[model samples]
Target: MRPGPSHLDTARAEIIVAEAGHRAAVDYVSRFGKWDARASVRQRPGRRLSGHRDELATPFPPELAPVAAHALVAGRGPDAVREVLTHSLYQYLHFTTELEELAVIPVVAKISRNRSGLDLPEAMRADAFKIYTDEAWHAQFSYDLVRQVERASGIAVRLPELPSFVERLDAVRASLDPAVRGLEALMFSIVSETLISSILADIPHDSRLPKAVRELVRDHAEDEGRHHAYFRQVLHAFWPALSARERRAVGPLLPQVVLAFLEPDYRAIGTALSAAGLAPDEVAQVMAESLPRRRVVDEVAGSAGSAVRYFTEVGALDDPATAEAFEASGLLLGAAR
Candidate 1:
């Protein structure tokens, strides 16, 4: 049977947007993309630190970690704040790189490979390859920047394993039906890409961070902006291709993905607080009293809000099972209509 006029109209719009987005990605790569770390260092030079102590400050957004700023954590003073902030940023970037490497690129490559040339469309395949190349470079540069920070600041970096985004998603997958596991991974990766697109503005613009570090983040953001456009277009293509059951499976996973990346890791946060010399009791009080979990959930919802809307528009949130999962996850309450 022929698809209705609305379906045809949506499909036509998707084609036009996808083509335009592909051109933009290519233009970005050719015009402004940095292909070399060494060249980036040379072009954006003179990253020497001035001898001021107040110059160093939180790298991640302060609002995201209100507990860290509480007397329990930051009272240890600027050095302690810097230590926790540095570790937080380090682990986050590392997780981002790993997510790109393991979660994102593989899904894109697989979709491109499994789908026929006509099925995947040449424009998307071409852009996916470009994204793959660009994402790998992103991972490498993120690693290099961590080493640079560690050497410059003299703070060794270590973070625990379980709540790492990958591990968390893997746990989520273990609870899901086997057939939908790949969809979970693909959708989670989609959320990862979406989350970073918004976060890019927060880091690079912070004057408190080192110039080189800020530059690194700025460049990554520029590339990811292009990537986000591509993935948004991919979603335009993705949802229509799925079965009803598959869509239901994907919906439940959306909130999980958002919280995995957006929610602060209390285990890691607690460890950082301890390393900064906070007492065990203080850490518990700070986690309980200073930072409200509801506020954190609200913040996470705001960060991943766009992706949630996208999932809703795609018919994922229409399923009762999916809506319940989101509510149970506590990222989206009363979102169903």
Candidate 2:
């Protein structure tokens, strides 16, 4: 994690290879990008939903909805499942759109404009603009689908104005030195893009889910594959440029950023459960039973495996302090080093 002339020298070697990789990153936004031909926003109305399931049919998987599982176990019927599914869709949409607009887009814009202080090639900067457009389109389609679902399902959305990640991120920033806030934000975006999202990975392939849900998520998942690669490369390019002082200041905070982004918003979940007719005590029990502390830790660690590996490859975790931070955070307990 030491940043210095020697580090910069190593970064130079990596940058040469990274430059070739960026050249391979096509301008997806212009060529085959969803914005041109395959974007959800461009699909004809008739092509939107599968005929197999009506729009009001289940919008999300029951297994993915912890509250829905609790309701069923308690003998609540189809109505409860519907409520949970509707709320789940709303939560997913709100989180996706808000996270993109608030957290990811700003960092990407920085890279595109060469404000990130990384020595990436022109192709990489050009790709950043493509990513920005991709993300904006993602947010737009997410918002659009949520409103469409509301109309079709006759359910109103109940969600926090900002995703819970934003609140946790604010706390993390407030605890950091003012000078490193920008660096922390950059690392946060890198971790977020590189981490595998269960929703994006699993939703599109679940045939039991509605067609629109699968298609919408599939489009997003495809786009994210590119985003993931770009950010991983970004990390490769950015880490070696950090000064030892900057690394020490910012490195250990990586695991905290992972947690901030991945941790479930239990408060919002509880509120949704209550709105779906669960009593206060029932919502408490449901949340406790469904998202036990150990389970949460394991999930975060598992999901962050790839992102952690990126740090390890770039020597961030080689810093004893950074390793200790990750270990203490429980995000590296069983992860392969």
Best by TM-score: 2
Q: Report lDDT (CA) for all predictions.
A: 0.63, 0.74
- In candidate 2, position 93 carries an lDDT of 81
lDDT per residue, candidate 1, 203-244, as tens digits?
A: 788776766667777877777776776676666556665556
Stretches of candidate 2 above 4 Å error?
Answer: 1-47, 50-53, 71-74
**RMSD for each of the candidates:** 6.8, 5.5
User: What would the C-alpha RMSD of candidate 2 be, to one decimal place?
Assistant: 5.5
Cα deviation at 34, candidate 2, in Å, is 11
Residues 1-337 of candidate 2 have per-residue lDDT tens digits of: 2111212221232332232232112112222334445533344232255344465566887767766777433467777678777888888888889889988999889878967766555566676887898888888888888887877777778877777898888888888877656677778889899998788888888877778888888888877887888788778767766666677888888888899888888877877787778888888888888889898888888888899988998899889999999989888754673
